[model samples]
Target: MRHGRSPWMIRLIVLVLRPLLMVVTRRDWQGAANLPEGGFVLAPNHLSHVDPILISHFMVDHGITPRFLAKDTIMRARGVGWVLRKAAQIPVYRSTDGATDSMRAAVQAVRDGEVVTIYPEGTITRDPDVWPMSGKTGAVRVALAAGMPLVPVMQWGPQEILWPYSKRLRLLPRRTIHVRVGDPVDLDDLHGKELTEPLLREATDRLMDALTAMMAEVRGELPSGERIDIHTLAKPRTTYKPKEI
Candidate 1:
């Protein structure tokens, strides 16, 4: 991380903004204690830029300063890159196949006892029909490689804070931002096993499952809504059984 204000300054900023954001959105966070105080992986469903900031700020209360994975091009920008670098954000080269280095960086960060936040779906959701799109397996890889715990976080109200695909900013009245965090996922179960495609897919699916559940709660939607079961969904579809012939 580049030289900047001390950790106290960062904590101070978070201390002030936490209550302000809570008041503005009437937000209430649940399961915040699920956040690990030391190094850990934070995977959240990405809908807007606000998701990262909100997650980071909420985790701050638990004394976790999370770093993000930004696009490499953004890091190429002269001034903005300087600030991002100073803030310790890692840049992944999305345009090329050189993302391995970025992955390595994330693994190292976790190994060094820091919280690394990743938006597994990569870009924000554009389907307009779901809580999240198919998640990338990079998060799983990092967690498994570093042997760190993975925490799934879900965020809501950002889309309303700034409408999707629009330049207009609308902090509409009475918007409530709710965030829910789930317990850390243990990678020990998969320890010493080869991370084949099927295994990685299964693991990423589990990550998204937890995220989806938490997001539904945050959005105040029923948990039974189009449930996503990774193990079941990964299986081939079978013919429906007859009711009573």
Candidate 2:
């Protein structure tokens, strides 16, 4: 299960996507030195639907082929599903018993020396200012279970190209995407500890705090220090439309 050469399908996708990403976005990627040589969990803030492509571009350019924990619906699609399977992406069956299975697969992937990218926020930001909200415990759980490094990667500017849940693409401006990779989160003290709900929540908060701070450095604006909880919102998490400022 160790990481090997990229499959043909993944290579083809890189060929097609790398050029398009370069054309549409300028890169301000930093902290490649922070990436570990072996397996690790990549925890990034979820901004827009286009985040996977943008983050994958950064990982691939730096010689790491990231395996995402994608939704099962995407994994069940006709053409794209086939590619994801071939590329060894993990599928998440949300709200079902199979959800735990997805976490197991992700932990195994990390243990087997593959980079697994999980969006800790679980979905696009529900915050009106597009700041990262509170995170789910899945990413921290996977990293702790596998005993691997948990790297916090913050990305800004994808929302400028494509607003959250929007179908329209803003390709005219050629935005510059800012990506900053932080040092592996220090969980050495909690590595062998039991995966209790309180412990997991604490770790998730640390990861989110690191992400928000890195994001502030990228955007040069301070966050409000309060994270929005999707569960508290009246509107449905996935169906709520983005309000214009």
TM-score of each: 0.80, 0.93
Worst 10 residues of 2 by lDDT: 236-245
Cand. 1 TM to true fold: 0.80
Compute the lDDT for candidate 2.
Answer: 0.89
Instruction: Quote the lDDT for 202 in model 1.
Output: 83
Model 2, residue 205: distance off in Å is 0.2
Name the weakest run of 10 consecutive residues (lDDT summed) in model 1.
Answer: 236-245
Tens-place lDDT per residue, model 2, 1-245, is 12568777788899888998889899999998999988999999999989889998998888888689989999999998998999888999999999999999999989998899999988899776789999999999999999999999999988887888778778767889999999999899898999999999899999999999999998889877589975576655554354542
RMSD of each: 8.4, 2.2
In candidate 1, stretches whose alpha carbon ends up further than 4 angstroms from where it belongs are 1-23, 95-97, 220-245
For model 2 the TM-score comes to: 0.93
